[model samples]
Target: MRAKDVTGIIGEEIAAEYLSRQGHEILERRWRGARGELDLITRDGAQLVAVEVKTRRGSGYGHPFEAITGPKLARLHRLLLEYCAAVHRLHERRRVDVVAVVLSGTSEAHAAEHLIRGVEHLKDVS
Candidate 1:
């Protein structure tokens, strides 16, 4: 697969691990709907979290969280509702999260070495 795609996959994996460590149960990864995609869907207690993962080689453009604009969040919200409806699921609460991963290099070694520097989990974004 392409380097960016690979990075994204790694990012999602890392995000899943991070969430698990934080006591959340991973419900899905790369969950999709007609509106958009959710990088990770997790259950934290009674809440359902819809996560968006952003992976980049550097922050030249901006922090990964900055990439999620108002419109993108709106779409994510719609997609989250669609997901719930599709699965006939309900939660006491719901939220949107963003996981940003930045790697120093494009290689796997660099990704593993510099993960701590690049990984940031922003919760309850919406």
Candidate 2:
């Protein structure tokens, strides 16, 4: 696999581990729907969190969290709803979050950030 793809796999694993450590039960990893993909879907207390994982080798283009735009957030929002409907988990509260992972040249992630409830219904995302 390509280095970037490998990096993503590692990022998702790290993201999942972080979520689990925070007391979230992973409902899905790399979940896909008609709209697009959600990197990590988990139940956080009584809410369903749709997470986007951004991973990069160092801070080349800036931190991973800087990657998610409004359109991407909207896409994830739709996919999250679709996921809830398909799985009959509609009653759960929902939110969007971004998880960033920075893999250093030393073959270890230098940092990871998890932003909770980071998205909202905004028109400026486009």
Candidate 3:
């Protein structure tokens, strides 16, 4: 796979781990619907959450959260609805969330040294 794809996968995994530590039960990862894909599906108590994960090696380009645009959020909202319909959870409480992950290192040689620069979770984003 491409490096970008690898980065995304790693980011999603990290986001999942982080959420799990925060007491969220992960329901799905990379869930695709007719509209788009959700990076992670989790349950926070009685509420269902759809998470969008954005990862970046560095902030030279922009922060990971900066990638989530207005149109993107709208698409995520539609995808969440589609997911709910598919899982027969239309009556459950749901909300959209974003998890931004930033890594500190850039080279494969320094992979072991690479650390998570930050993890920012925004709830009810849409």
Candidate 4:
């Protein structure tokens, strides 16, 4: 796979582990619906969470969370609704979340080191 694709996969995996350590039960990863895909689906107590993950090697463009614009969030909300219907959980409490994964190192050559600069989780984003 391309470096970008690999970065995303690694980020999602890291995000999942981080969330799990934080007491969130992961229900799904890379869930695709008619609308689009949700990076992660997790349960935080009684509420269902739909996570959108953004990963980057550096913040030259901007913080990873900045990538999630208003339109992207709207699409995520629609995807969340579709997911609820698919799983027959329309009545359950739900919320949107964002997981920003920033990796250390300036180039792909250092990917072998596999260092994480940070992982930020934003809950109830929508």
Candidate 5:
């Protein structure tokens, strides 16, 4: 795999591990298609969460969470709609989360922070 692809995989692994440690049951990883890509899908308590993972090399580029701008969130929102329809009927209990993963090339170095219950539905998409 390419450098970025490898980094992305590592990032996802970190995110999954963190979620598990936080009492979340991972349901899926990289739930994606032509519409867009969702990094992780997990359950927190009684609610299902759709997560977007953003991995970065360092702080030079900017904060990983800041990369998740409004347009990106909108796409994630639509993808969440697809996931909800395919997996379950209820929508009120679902939420969107952002996982910011910081990667290091050195061994024994990795970090991930899951932004729980982040992102809200837009008032108007049109």
Candidate 6:
């Protein structure tokens, strides 16, 4: 796999671990539909959450969370609805969350030093 893809996989893994620690039950990973993909789908109590994972090597372009644009958010919302309908899961409350994972540096040493240097969880993001 490409380095970018590997980075994303690592990011998702880290995000999943973080969410699990936060008491969120992971329902799915890399949930795909006609619209697009949701990195993680989780159940937090009675609320169903659709999570988007953004991974970055550094801040050369921007923060990992900055990659989530208005259109991208809209697509994620649509995907969530589609996923709900397909699974026949009725959720009284639903939300969109973002898991931003930033690595320490671009060098291999940095990558080996810390898989994820920082992680930010933004809940109920629109």
Instruction: Return the top candidate by lDDT.
Output: 4
| lDDT comparing candidate 1 with the true structure | 0.81
Best by TM-score: 4
- Clashing residue pairs in candidate 2 are none
Q: Give one clash count per candidate, in the order shown.
A: 0, 0, 0, 0, 0, 0
Q: TM-scores of the models, in the given order?
A: 0.87, 0.81, 0.94, 0.95, 0.77, 0.91
**What is candidate 5's lDDT per residue for 1-126, written digit by digit as tens?**
466676677777877888888888999898975697788888888877787777767556776777878898888878877887777646647778887776543322332332232212221221
Q: Where in model 4 is the C-alpha error above 4 Å? A: 109-112
Which lDDT tens digits does candidate 6 get at residues 17-105?
99999999999999989878899999998888999999888888698878889999998888889999889875557899999999877
Model 5, CA-based lDDT: 0.69
lDDT of each: 0.81, 0.72, 0.90, 0.91, 0.69, 0.87
TM-score-based ranking: 4, 3, 6, 1, 2, 5
- Candidate 4 yields a Cα-based lDDT of 0.91
As a whole number from 0 to 100, the lDDT of residue 91 in candidate 5 is: 60
lDDT, candidate 3, 13-89, per-residue tens:
99999999999999999998877789999999999999999988888869888898999999888899899999999
Question: Model 6, stretches more than 4 Å misplaced?
Answer: 108-113
Residue 33 of model 5, lDDT score: 57
lDDT of 4 by residue, 1-126 (tens): 677788888899999999999999999999999878999999999999999999998888689999999999999989999999999999999999999999986676545567899999998996
Ranking by lDDT: 4, 3, 6, 1, 2, 5
- On the 0 to 100 scale, the lDDT of residue 16 in model 4 is 98
Better of 2 and 5 by lDDT: 2
Candidate 1 matches the true fold with a TM-score of 0.87
